[model samples]
Target: MNFLIEENRNLAPYCSMKAGGNAKYLVQPKSVSELCEAVAYFRSRDEKYIVVGNCSNLLFPDSGYDGAVIITCGIRGISYENGVITAHCGDSLSSLARVACENSRAGLEFCYGIPGTVGGGVYMNAGAYGGELSQYFIRGSFIDKNGEIVVIENNDMDFGYRHSRLNYEELILLSAEFSSVEGDRDAVRARMEELMAKRKASQPLEYPSCGSAFKRPAGHYAGALIEQCGLKGTSVGGAQVSVKHAGFVINTGNATATDVTELLSLVSDTVFNETGVRLEPEIRIIK
Candidate 1:
């Protein structure tokens, strides 16, 4: 009931790639009650809706979405006490990492440079530098499709390579609790700095991308396979496979969602033809 709704909202500004078309209606609810109310309101009217976290790993089509887009970026709340970090779904991963580092925690350093909310990271089981969210997560709270809050333990999360069971379900992550061990504060900071430096050195961080475009192929690297297929630097409209890192497809200014989709399809097909192994896209495309 306390949601702000806007008409003809531009979706690009909300997303990392800045390439999406407009959303017919956009809603931003401030709290759990407001979010649930908005969901119920939409459902009562038989309207379609999509929930967006930080909008980092999504590509919205050029045709635009006809339904409501509920953005959760303003729902952030974080608390740390007794070696436990409890963060709301909208809390940034970078912020979470900083909080952990300041508290002498070591497990979350790998997420220091990740550009997404805690909820999105958990949904994707996001990992980097050989460390993943699953390792530190103790439990998560989510709102089911019926607007019921449910707590799921780490074992029930079913986290796998860049995916969790939540990806296939209609649950909306509300918050997460991570358990960390005490370590040297300075050492934790140093580790985070080193990981950030490595990310900057190897990735095309200058452009807008959804990080790795594809999951790693079996027994081989996705980027290496793309490079071997001579698909590096390939472009479709304003979207291009990054030359610096073939695993990334970047928005080189004025790119459309269609462009990104086309380039991804081309890369996947080419890689499969050359290696006889299919490449699964890591970036989620929303219609």
Candidate 2:
């Protein structure tokens, strides 16, 4: 029992959307052993389960989740030695990037502005400004459904644009090791600052959003397609396609998950109808 289990907990505070129903049960596991214990406990009773990182890319239904919501945010740890950086699943991407910069490492600069955990970034193969996590990733550790720790190499991860093999597996990432080259600390800091400035300038940082709303379609940009369809600033309830960036669907205060879903559907439909190309959501919707 490494986790303190709570009953009927409100989930809104845990998600970036700041709008979600309650969870029948919630567990925050602080370590790998504790995490395994919680998983085993849930499995013994044959209960449904879902693991969450920082909840940056999630939208939980208004009806709430009927099973266990396992939060891994408390399991944080990060270290660097011999040019390899090891980050626990709960370690935030911003923290990791800062650590890299402090060590004068150069590969993780693009991750400086990404608001999520290392586990979440690895799962999504997170990228920005021509740099992706997959480039620096060397290997990772994951706990399988049976509570077995397994190590996987970068090639085995099957990383792609905003996706990885972890999405299909019943495995929980424990930690990851990345390889980075030594660089001038000043240069590294400058690059990170530049990326952060670009994000602040181009994204709707003032509103609540799940970053990019849709995956890039083949032969077309999702935002360009959306803007072409005249869906920018279009609203459904409190949710709206951002006027600043058509690729973002923002919660303009008090937006429900349903509202975001409705807006996403409308945008996808309109874009598909206009461009003959279907857009896929990058945001993960959970119920």
Which candidate wins on lDDT?
2
lDDT of 2 by residue, 143-261 (tens): 77777889999999989999898888877888999989998899999999999999999999998889999999989999999999989999999999999999999999999999999
Clash count for each candidate, listed in order shown: 0, 0
RMSD from true fold, candidate 1: 1.1
Span of 10 residues, lowest total lDDT, candidate 1: 30-39
The Cα RMSD in angstroms, rounded to one decimal, for candidate 2 relative to the true structure is: 1.0
Mind giving the per-residue lDDT tens digits that candidate 1 earns over 1-287? 57788998889988888898889889988776777777888888888898788899999898888999988877888989999999988889998889998888878889899999887899999889998999999999888877788999999989999989888998888889998888889999999999999999999999998999999877999999999999998999999999999999999998999999999999999989988989999998997
Give lDDT per model, in order: 0.90, 0.90
lDDT assessment of candidate 1:
0.90
Off by over 4 Å in 2: none
Error of 1 at 9 (Å): 0.9
Question: RMSDs, each prediction?
Answer: 1.1, 1.0
Residue pairs with clashing backbones, model 2: none
User: Candidate 1 has what TM-score?
Assistant: 0.97
